[model samples]
Target: MEQRWDGSVVLEAGRLLFRGRLGTTHAHAHAAVQVVVVRSGTVELADRYGGRLAVSAAVIPSRATHSLHAEDAQGTVAYYDSDSHVGRALRSRFPTAPGDRVTDWTAAAVQSACPPDAPGGGRAAAAPHPAVGRAIDRVRSRLHGPVTLEEVATALHLSPSRLGHLFAEELGLPFPAYVRWVRIRRAIELVRSGATLTQAACGAGFYDSSHLTRVVHEMFGMAPSQLLRDVQWEPGPQRIRPSGPGLAGAP
Candidate 1:
């Protein structure tokens, strides 16, 4: 039987945090680096290569395909932009081999690396290129309509090819992937504001509910209903929080 995810979610620029019971998730990959800290029961992390590790805590590197199997297990899951301060810190502290994607750690170690202050305040991360920044703002503003890289680039006075290159170089994800993320985030925002899934999908510029459902499941490993159903949501900060202490100084 497929389990339901019940938890609280906090979204900040470049970071998303969830605390609650984890549902079984299908194998999926996204651009953010993911960290899972299991508090009770077990959550299994499986890779595409048939390797499986039952972990209390683990970090899955960016864009690495994997799945989670958790039943009646309570834990925390955090997604971080690979280029953000804390994301860089975690990757730095727990360096992975060239091809390795998932690193399992003891619960204590995971907690220590991700201290309460780690997600709050510290030094500001380097800003993205000016064009990339503008392009992002443009995407957010146009989420209610069709947004295309060519149109965004034209408005920003850059060729589509140049803009696409910058997105990959600065954000570590392609332009299309970033657009999908923005759309999904916008849909979640609409749902949090009391819109039904169908309404949220249209409001977020998805073709319809099914389009939104497919995107959510592909990127997050759960249907929009399962992911957004009856969960507490903390107001997200207007901007990304500065990096804090912990993994930054880790060896």
Candidate 2:
């Protein structure tokens, strides 16, 4: 699914971003828990077994199978490393995910997702340890390439075992798992930037388009065809906007 660069920001150290109109995603699950604050319109989140709920804003637990939709729903989606201190904090903040509406953190978190750059980025938080943050940056720096944790650790003058622990203890997600997720995200971004699936797959470190397709569906739930169905994107000065209109009513 390739399109022009939609006006969205990937911000707050890769933990927060604005989900633009890529239409509905295929049924998928995520490795990291998510908090979505609907800005313009209502969105319906449907679970795998067909159960559904309509909410203005929602917190979704990790590994939960679900898909979100609205004709043109726009929102800030924040992701937390499932094992990080902040990720653990979110459980308390939400209390009831995929069912709970955000009460306190949405406003601040959504604002934080927006930055000067469209598809923008910022430095990671120096939590858990600076080394862990550095490792994350290194992985993110290479969108397409096989980078082992050992390599990253070696570069940082640490053993693979110690660095792997940093990833787990500090970031919550292990080095390998985090790297996988980053590759998937990178492929999606490449597709959004107008690359074909094959190109995106290669550019984002996948073995092939088939690999990208399968993983995208697994991680995000939406199949490639479904996600790419009507993706509209652009490179622009992005800003927070109301979801506007589409898909509503308690499902």
Candidate 3:
């Protein structure tokens, strides 16, 4: 039989897939487009301005501040980089701005919009700029330490100003924002391994547990304590094997 888990997180070059139970959330927003595919029950979302929606499956645009309430709902939440083709396609099909678009969608429609995965686990049809790619590599390698745009630019033989421009142009987000997202991802991995909030915070290069808490809450709309509790975590293809307490059903 296929294994089941309380939660599973799969990371790729340009995508992050999370599957499991969801609880009521605080209002928050991040820099990626979110696609939720529901397997059962309904997901009720409220925007920062009092807009409300109940969806089985939905696509939320990047930077759209919203709170989610899903008492018994279980499904997959896939986050795609705003610059990736998938992200662009989703925005094109859905056509809504931040805080304005949380339209209901279907699994088949989402899958159809997703192009074939490129080699090496990248779903982005277009590769990032050469400098941006190198910068990403450098950032990934130094998630546990300070990584500055100037340092990366110097190493790549480019000026900090130029590198920053390229990052925004190619990734659709600022360099610092990208680094913060990476740190968040790393922290989540650490939490899934049973690390305490402080430990995970330090491991992911946050100043302290409080900093991590704030970032997680702002980006994901939930504190780590609630999101990582009693969940089995599955890392990406390049990381360690899946291990942790299991959920009751297949995700």
Each candidate's TM vs. the true structure? Answer: 0.79, 0.61, 0.73
Give me the runs in candidate 1 sitting further than 4 Å from their true place: 1-3, 82-84, 88-100, 103-112, 115-126, 231-251
lDDT for each residue of candidate 3 in 1-251, tens digit (9 for 90 to 100): 21123456566656766666544656887767677666777677776668677766666766667777775677766777665677666656543223354443332245444532323323654535788878888888998989999999999999999999998666656788878877887886676667888999999999999998888778887666655555544343523223332211111
Model 2 residue 24 distance off true place after TM-score fit, in angstroms: 6.1
Lowest summed lDDT over 10 consecutive residues: which window, candidate 3?
242-251
Q: Give the top-scoring candidate (TM-score).
A: 1
**lDDT tens string, model 2, 1-251?**
32111234342334535455424555666666566666666566676667666656655655566776664555555565454444555544443334323233343233333322233232334555778778777887886888898899998999999998877665445687777777866775676667888998999888888887787677765555554544455445222222321111101
- Misplaced by over 4 Å in model 3 are 1-7, 11-14, 81-100, 103-112, 115-126, 233-251
Better of 2 and 3 by TM-score: 3
Which candidate, 1 or 2, would have the higher lDDT against the true structure? 1
Error of 1 at 243 (Å): 32
Best by lDDT: 1
